[model samples]
Target: MSPLRPEELQALLHAAVDDLRPAPDGYERIRAGIDRRRRWRVPAYAAGGAVLAALAALAFFAISPRSHTEVVEPASPVTGQLGSGALAPTASRTASPPVIGPALSPSLSSKGGPTGATATGSATPSTPAPAGSPTVTPTRRAENSSPATVAKDGDIDGDGVVDPDISYNGTALVVTLSHNHQTRAVTLAGVVTPLHYTVTDLDDDGRGEILVEVSGAGGVTTYDVVRLQPDGSLRALSKGPLPLVVGASSSSGAGFSCSGGLVQVRSGTSDDGTTYQVTTTSWRLSGVTFAPVGKATTTSYDTTSSAADPFTARCGTL
Candidate 1:
């Protein structure tokens, strides 16, 4: 349809308002409107089809497949809470650093070897681990208290030769010997328990002897001596002149002694019922036996209750 010229539009407007009362500035308003349309409105309406075509082209381009994709990289790991001071995002995977524990010192393993640490992160050998070397410690404490032990290994016989080892483990039934390797022992009968043992050169001889104390009847300790023979065997020495084996020493000082470079035994009695006469008998080593050597007597006469020298001194002069 053809757009109307200014004159035609004016004529139509006048006819429309013919019987209406004109406004004070209504004609001026009409004149201004016509001028505006002549400059802008007429051109816009005439080219309406071109304007619509241009808009359609722009819309097609906007919806077309894009050359590059808008890839939003993932937000970095949040080391801290939202409100907390968060470290700035970084491209590195490790971010800050691994939370490594303090370095630990080498510790002893059960077999007394240094236990080494293992690779953790990425299996790097020297990488500080989340936990360093194990903080384990091996205790070197003795858990069990040992029983009494007796072991003396050297020249055990008077001959200038070393023989089997001799040892007594307190209450054991046998005396442990090293060479025969515990094959020889003093399995004394009627024995309760072994109390103690001694090893020394008993006769001023170059060899050593074993003095064993065995518990006897009524808890009385019987002391016995044994020698290691040159034949690698043991022989119980007949206690020279003393009563069958008993005691380190009698209550009255009657016991065995090698104090004078000779093996001897002492025996004594208060003779009278009231301790008037003290007769002490003595013996010296005779070959492999002990024979009586004479006796010494001590007499107390003044009092009926009686008096006598101590048993130890009874044989002191002899």
Candidate 2:
């Protein structure tokens, strides 16, 4: 372990410097590689930023709520009418109420006029008007005595006798009895035109019932049934629209017929603009009202394509 002098240390350092070597293009090559890497990284970062922005916009729209509007309609009243003499109320006579005495039971007077009947079912016979003293007349009799046009005859009150007669007063249809001379006015509550009328003793009682055919706007047809009361008022037999056959489309129509005291209704409508459906329903009298007794059938046929569908369905025992 001998220590060298200062001159020896200086010569050793000079020798280490002479042993080192340098590459010619070291700095220039490093600078060119860094520039190439930066060019590729800039495009990749730009593309990544664009993708993130698009995802944010799509999520915003997906979570937003949409707006909607709805429409509502008012409830309609129930009323109906029947056209032609075909519609009738046909129930068994067993359903009829007991035979109350005729609605207008009057005793005969000397002049063949009405003799007042008492509340106790007793009649007080009237003699001639005291030998026509002064010949006084009633003003009410003159004003309301415009002879009514008898439209039909029926036992509107179900009183075992068809003593009620229908007539057309200037304002409405009037039902009157000959004995009491009381009048009942009939009107279609929600209907527009009372087009036609007919009467039939469907119940086989001595009294008849009235069926009126009415037409509303948009070619809507309906039927109404009215019963005359002994108390001088008319009552609706059908409290609502009695659907014989309801039209569902502009080109559709309904028809009804009666046979053997049974009513048959036939209707047709286009179901989806491509298929047409026809329905038939049969009804019978139950007690004071009509009920669907037999089977109802609906048959559908395709109109757009050939022979793809001609289906039939039994709508249960309606």
C-alpha local distance difference test of each model: 0.37, 0.41
Encode model 2's per-residue lDDT on 1-318: one tens digit a residue: 989989999999999898777787888899989998899998989999999989998997776543212221221111111222211122111121112111222111111101221111112122222332332111111212221111113334433222324544445666664334456686655432322444443333333445554444455555555544334466556622253333334346555554445556666677465567757676664445677757888866555667522221111001
lDDT of 1 by residue, 1-318 (tens): 999999999999999988797688998999999998889977798699678888899998776644322222222222221122221222212221111212111110111111221111112122343332322111111112111111111224322112223334333234333222334565544332323344444443334455555445542344555655545456666555432333222222233444433444433434333343333444454324556665554433322443432332111111
TM-score of candidate 2 against the unseen true structure = 0.36
Candidate with best lDDT? 2
Off by over 4 Å in 2: 1-172, 178-181, 190-195, 229-233, 239-251, 271-276, 298-318
List TM-scores for all candidates, in order: 0.34, 0.36
- Candidate that would win on TM-score: 2
Q: Show how many residue pairs clash in every candidate, following the order shown.
A: 1, 8
